[model samples]
Target: MERRTAEDRGTGTDGDTAAAPLPGRAAVVIVGGGVLGASVAFHLAEAGVRGVLLLERDTPAAGSSGKPVGGVRAQFSDPLNIRIGRRSLEAWRAFGERPGADIGFAQVGYLFLLGDATERALFEEGVAAQNALGVPSRIIGPAEAAALCPYLDPDSIVAAAHCPTDGYALPREAVAGYLRAAARHGAAIRTHCPVTAIDIRDGALDAVRTPHGTVRTTTVICCAGAWSAEVGAMAGVRLPVTPLRRQIAFTGPLDTPPPRIPFTLDFASTAYFHNDGAGGLLLGMSDPRQQPGFGREFSREWLAPFREAAGRRAPALATLPVSHGWAGLYETTPDHNALIGEAADVPRFLYATGFSGHGFLQAPAVGELIRDLYLGREPFLDIGPLAASRFDGPAGEGNAGHTGARPEAHII
Candidate 1:
């Protein structure tokens, strides 16, 4: 294998991109090249951590990280996650200074549409948490919501929450930025290197075996997205992550582009749409009947339910002709939250996965958190609650340990 200080710079999602001669040894080995892996490697290498090697099964971002566009927001129901979102947004806004890449970040804002009093109340409470953390998000009436996004019907939504600072950025560019920076800092990134096995001895990680070759190391970081469970299993750790297919479609370019609107979502139906940055719109929704698996083939059949939800929420979008689509996997857990913590049984084996669909948005912060872990420093915040060991207890008891799990309410 060749040493890849550069090349293979896709966001750490599906796979593809790089490889040079493989090193026989490394101080650390990162599995998965998705945005999380790239972010983590960048942080570690930037901090002067030596012998860093990031291996990908395919081109970085080839997985879910390679989405057409990724949402970034600080809108969360819990303070802990809100803090994570806030810090990440700051990093994204200043990405050019740190990773030095134009990620095409836009702060058009995020609008969450509430269709009923129950959802309205929940968002009202969430907005308070967000405001306390310095996020300028507010709950607005249907009239104000329709004003912000003219495509919405004031009669359809009872209430809405808008955060003027939240928006999205290019995922593939973000991944390349992080990995390219990591390379400059003396980190080695190799592509086409699927981790076949992890060697453990006496409860400590000894080495990582891949299709290319085995590299001896005491530290291993698992940033694998949908395949995180398989990576965790190689280390005898139980990461209860399941893969689910999420699809999105783009309308053909129009004669008149829709006005640039906040990334909007109909919270009640989980339907959402945003400006494609082209003369079109991007549309998607969660198919309640979607089976949990690694099947990411874009099936137009799912669009039927998406359009049905749009009919009730945004009538105009219901009849919009979709030009093309893409499908990706979401590494979901029982709680639909992320799993970020080191394994208790496996020494120095760290993992930050099961992000469900927030991996790209949370990559920067997760990278910092894992870097702190490898350095034995306290993280910026307590992530102990997101430990996989939480599953050690009975079902629904995932929030019983460490700092205790906070409520994860916002969904799109």
Candidate 2:
């Protein structure tokens, strides 16, 4: 993959240039330049912590962060997820008003369509859970849902969970904003620098070895996204994240685009689509047949299934022409949730990965959470439920029990 920095994308900088010389040592070494890593660096610097080094093999947002559909929402099945989503949404809203960041965030809303009784029940439960966390999400009947998003085929959906505060943002902008801010706050970002190994001494993190040089740091955080497992292995800690290929297609400009609608999802099929801010529509769906790997090549085979599913849920887009398509990896876990906090077995080694497909949306809250964990401060939200220690059984006997974790149905 080609290495491109935020400067290449023309995102304003906070005065410090990126791709600086790899230093011999630092207080903390963040191995990854995606949004999550950048967020951690930015928050740490903002909190008065200095000498932080952020390394990226490619560039900021070059991984999953760059390819995401950029949906931000607070409607989640779990209470922790809902709380994190709410906090993340608040940060997204404040980005534009803050220094060096305007993520082009829009609150067009999100609507998950429920087709059957079981789907309706699950969605209702999810909505109640979200509401209890102060998220303004509700289960609306088909008619109300259709009123909110007229493009949806009401007959195909029995009920829908709608959250008006949920929407999308520009991932690249967010990454660039964080990098620039981190740089200004005395953090160094190095692109095209990959950590080859994690040095551990006496069961404690010693340093990070890279091609350029070895960074002697006691604290290391892995935000490598899909490649987290490989990075963790260098430190003798096994991560359960698997890289799953996800594809998305964009429609050509429409003569008459549908009214500004929420990011719509067919909960049963996981088929989803939303406006691209341009006149076109962005659409995608998970391929059940897709095997976990690093394959990021787009496939024509997925187009037909996505179209068919979209047509059934949103008849208005049945015949829309797909002008272009792209593929990205989703660092999925057994529970379809993120693994946050310090690794129980690896002292001085922290983690903020395994977000399944929700990393980009949750990066803001995650950045803060990781900063809190690293600094030994009270985190804004209790992240015990997301610890990597949850899968301590047969499934994790060899690879840290990541395979034993349960699957989350609310994915997508």
Candidate 3:
């Protein structure tokens, strides 16, 4: 990919000119210009912090932030996730109303179809957990699920969990909004400026080395998404994040598109489909055999399984011609959850990566949590459950008690 700055695309914010050069230092340097990093920068600047520099190896939303199907929801098996989802939903709604940064956020809701007794039980537990956290999600019968999403095959679904306030937002637009807001608040965003190394002295952050120049800063936040592990290594922190490839296919404009349904998912097979909002359907399924790597090439072999799953769950979409599709990486951790906090060993080196597939939807709340951590204030949300220390131990030996069932069960 060609490296280009925000100025090259004429997207530079106020006070940023096309001919401006990168500064030698800043109070805080954020690596990665995706939604997560952009949100952090925006929140920090909005909190009265000055001289904030956000560096992107490529343009904003060039990673998973730009590639997801854009599903947002508050339904989760974990309370932390549910709380974060609730706050993010609020932030998305506020962003949609903000002038000059209207992210097209739609509360189309999310429907998780349960196919069997075990799945139904799990969803019931999830709904209870979500409701306890103030999320208005509940278990609905197959009839109600099918009525809400007419294309679904009621015979195949036993039960489902629905949350009307959950929905989708344009990831690119969210990133743009955050970037513009951050820059307008005196945050300098430098795209295409990748960090080569992080300088550490006496177990503390010293500076950040980049191709453009060395930035002497005491704080650095790694929001590099899939590349977070590599970025963490520079600071001598072993981040347990690996990039998993995921693909999505878009069907051609249908003669009769399905109803404007919620983002529907089959909990058993991890198969999901939703309206693309442009008279087409977007579909994807997790490949059980997919290995961890940076490879994002779309595979023709997976199409057969995708069709089979989609056909079994929503028969009407089985025959639709796939018009186009793309692939992106998911920054997955061992438990398929995010690692968010400052490193215990590496001073001033904070991280917010490893969301598996839900990072974009959770970025808004994470930005505020990170800002709180940096400012030494109590965060609005409890982020202790997502600390990096949870994985601390000998390198090869697994942490037994910590290794439990994955918290985020609805990965699709």
Q: Which runs of model 1 end up more than 4 angstroms from their true locations? A: 1-19, 396-410
lDDT of 2 at 41: 89
Global lDDT of each candidate:
0.86, 0.83, 0.83
Candidate 2 per-residue C-alpha lDDT over 1-412 given as tens digits, one digit per residue, 9 for 90 to 100: 6666655432223222243567888999998888899899899988888789988887678899889999999887767778888999999999876536789998999988899898888778778888888999898899999998888888988899899999999998999888878877788887778899988888898889887888999999999999999999999887888999999998868888757889988887788888888888898888888999999888778877777887888887777888888999999877787889788888878899998898888989998999999889998888887777776676643242232223443456
C-alpha displacement of 5 in model 3, angstroms?
Answer: 15
Tell me each candidate's TM-score: 0.94, 0.92, 0.93
Best by TM-score: 1
lDDT of the structure predicted as candidate 2: 0.83
Task: Tell how far residue 19 is off in model 2, in angstroms.
Answer: 6.3
- State the weakest 10-residue window (summed lDDT) of model 3: 396-405
Global lDDT of model 3: 0.83
Instruction: Evaluate model 1: give its lDDT.
Output: 0.86
Quickly count the clashes in candidate 3: 0
Cα lDDT tens digits, model 3, 327-357, are 9999988777788999988888999998889
